[model samples]
Target: MQTNMFKRLKRTTRTALGFACLLIGIVFILLPGPAVIFIPLGLALLSLEYDWAKVWLKKSQKYFRQAAVKADQALHWFGKKLRN
Candidate 1:
């Protein structure tokens, strides 16, 4: 019984925090803040209790990875151009 209560409390806390982060992230999209960081963080927290969040989190991870690769390539190209 104690464990069940603890689990419920934990889930509720997680859900509240997840929603808070997601909402903040959305707000950051319109305003000036770190949406990239918060969105993924919210998704990660929500993913602990929700399947949809998990799916979105995976997609976000892939997109970020691709963006990172492209950014790295661009920097490499810029460095090479400077040398020449």
Candidate 2:
């Protein structure tokens, strides 16, 4: 019985965290903040509860990583040009 209670508590905590992440992601979308980061984080939290969310999180992570790489490359190119 105690074990069951602990399991229930853990589940509830995850649910709450997932919902909070989702809400934060939405807010970030409307505001001028880290929407890209928050949206992926929210999807990751939701992935704990749903398979579809897991897929979305994976894709989002990939896209974000690609964007980061591109941005880094652009910055490097800009720095080289500036030095020249």
Assess each prediction's global lDDT (C-alpha) against the native: 0.95, 0.84
Off by over 4 Å in 1: none
What C-alpha lDDT, on a 0 to 100 scale, does residue 50 get in candidate 1? Answer: 98
Query: Number of backbone collisions per candidate, in order?
Result: 0, 0
lDDT of 1 at 38: 92
lDDT string, candidate 2, 9-84, tens digits? 8878877787788778889879888888678777877787779889988898898899999999999999999999
lDDT (tens digit, per residue) of candidate 1 on 1-84:
999999999999998999899999999989999988998999999999999999999999999899999999999999999999
Worst 10 residues of 1 by lDDT: 14-23
lDDT over C-alpha atoms for residue 47 of model 2: 84
Q: Give the Cα RMSD of candidate 1.
A: 1.6
Residue 10 displacement in candidate 1 (angstroms): 0.8
C-alpha root-mean-square deviation, each candidate: 1.6, 2.0
Off by over 4 Å in 2: none
